[model samples]
Target: MVFTPPQNYNEIKSLLENLEAYINSPEFHEIDSLIKMPIIHYQFESIHPFYDGNGRTGRIINMLYLVQQKLLDIPVLYLSSYIIKNKNDYYRLLQEVRTKDAWEEWIIWMLKGVEITALETIKVVNKIKILMDDYKKEIRSEFSFYSHDLINILFKHPYTKIDFLQKELGVHRNTASSYLNALAKHGLLNKVKIGKSNYYINQKLFNTLTKR
Candidate 1:
């Protein structure tokens, strides 16, 4: 269904300005963050200020708002994945808000997304930590060039290159290449050559990130 947003440029402009003010308003500050965010998200989406990227921008605003409230140390709790999985419900609930004034259902849906996303993020973080520890022990036992910095560099960039290691570890090109090659040879990294450049893939880290 096609929803008609505000068509007048001046009206859209004013609504967007009001949204900015509302977010920083004392009335907004009085509401709990979990409650306030969904309301703000609805307001932004309804305003639909931009022709494109409204959904993406709204999600970003949700994260930023959480950070601004000091509820998160970083803006890592993303609801995009959850929304993607339940896109039909997301759109339906949003439409219901405009048509039937279904604020409760919309707020509940958003809150549930927040809860599920937060839990999933925690699980992913724990998995990464365990994988990093395993890599540390195995690489230290097998390789002479093992260091905490090496482990960090490998995990920090799932698709790592010799140039990355060279700059991060303050090593020469040959030295970085030797380290990456050794890891690839040991089956710790899968080395793929793209054109003239080689990228060492941390398969476990890549899987962790891309896993559904």
Candidate 2:
């Protein structure tokens, strides 16, 4: 495989220097991190320091920077989906900066992307909360001896094994297997065997998380 970057050695070196200066400079913290994220993103993509995955790495940094700056409580926002949906404009705005020095439009585009992605993230989170509540109610009503901790563990991970449930509930392997099998019978989980171990998959939570 061949890999290419937009910048040469000297250009990349200069870009790195600028990046360090920006990180330590007052302007980075003087403005809100959310407001500064777009400029930082543009610089990173323009530098294109990596042979591959520059965009992916820069996007990850965007989310990390938000957390680092305490702008977000969690890095759950799905910024890439918005960018993927508007793939053309995303690149075009970046190019506008390189060609015409259009900082305003590029920044605005990124800000809008953040806003839209944030709202989408909120909606997904609320949906998951509703699902979790429904699952709790159904589990409580369906099972006379249901463990709330078991429910927490299930939602924490969409996939669970006999060993996992056994450890979480401090029950024997047979008991754990029985619980998973019961859920499968109730249509709340699907049982699948991988090698020697069996896993119970939470279909509804998986669907909600992977919806978009």
Candidate 3:
């Protein structure tokens, strides 16, 4: 389907000025940041300042605002999944606000997205923590020589390379390869070849992330 942006090209700068004035105003800060977040997001999206990447920039601003307002210790909770899940509703609500000045509905929808996404993110974090604990126990039992830091680095991403292990552990390439191979043997990682390079994939963590 074709996309309809919230603002006309000529209106971008003035809309952004309005956005800036609102954000910098005492009234904006008087409200609870969480209460203000949806309003800010809607305004930013409606402004549509950039020629491209407005959606992405708007999403980043959401996390940054949380951090700036000290609403979150970390800028981790994301609304992308929520927006993607309710793709049609997301666009429709924005359009409603533009066409019919349906501000209440749009605001409520955004607030709901934030609440739902926060809960889902918390669940994902807890699951990852549990998986990390299990990995520590299994690794310690299987390989007494394995470093906890090494295990952590693997969890940092779904796939890791020998070079990463080598750099982190400050060991030779062969040693890193051997460690990865041992993990693969214990079903901790799956070995995969891409072109001429070998990589160790953290299947459990990968599956957990990709599950939803």
Candidate 4:
């Protein structure tokens, strides 16, 4: 019983119509198509189409649709991170689209965010993978075993905290801290002081993040 956008989105069932019709159509190259994804995303959020996780759901749909249309090879284009960084402007831009006919500005901002996000994500992913490979070749894990999921999480959140890993991997605090410290001791993570907490973000990953 998932909702689906109808034929004429602006007319009836606009939220569902806009999303379903656009995805079902072969209109990926058009500017309208490109703009439609985010527009529908904004409208979906504004309409509060779902009762729970509406914002996150809409955002996930945005990335999924982009890759569905073959515009992105991977779901690495995360505008949410960018929007999260500039929350005020994010809402304002979307509001302008709903209020005025300022398609140009909205599209411009959306496209720019897409380009910046895609390239930035690409850089980070590549760098993180490279560093992970270096770890495998240089420092082998001690006795017993470890999970390969570590590399995946490291790629997702380069600055992963011990507490976070403990929760994720279902390990004790000391074990989590040890894993993090191991990564750092082996010259993988660079301990950074962000305000109060000491973060063990991968330095090689940070290099990618900070590199233009």
Best by TM-score: 1
Error of 2 at 98 (Å): 0.5
Global fold similarity of model 1 (TM-score): 0.94
TM-scores for all candidates? 0.94, 0.88, 0.87, 0.59
lDDT of 3 at 98: 74
Cα lDDT listed for each candidate:
0.94, 0.84, 0.84, 0.71
Model 1 CA deviation exceeding 4 Å by range: none
**Candidate 3 TM-score versus the reference:** 0.87
Maximum-lDDT candidate? 1
Could you report the Cα RMSD, in angstroms, for every candidate shown?
Answer: 1.4, 3.0, 2.6, 8.0
Models ranked on TM-score = 1, 2, 3, 4
Clashes of each: 0, 0, 0, 3
Per-residue lDDT of 92-120 in model 3, one digit per residue for the tens?
A: 88878778898888888988988898888
Runs off by more than 4 Å, candidate 3 = 1-11, 25-27
Question: Between prediction 1 and prediction 2, which has the larger lDDT?
Answer: 1
- Report lDDT (Cα) of residue 198, candidate 4: 68
**Model 3, residue 187: what's the lDDT?**
90
lDDT of 1: 0.94
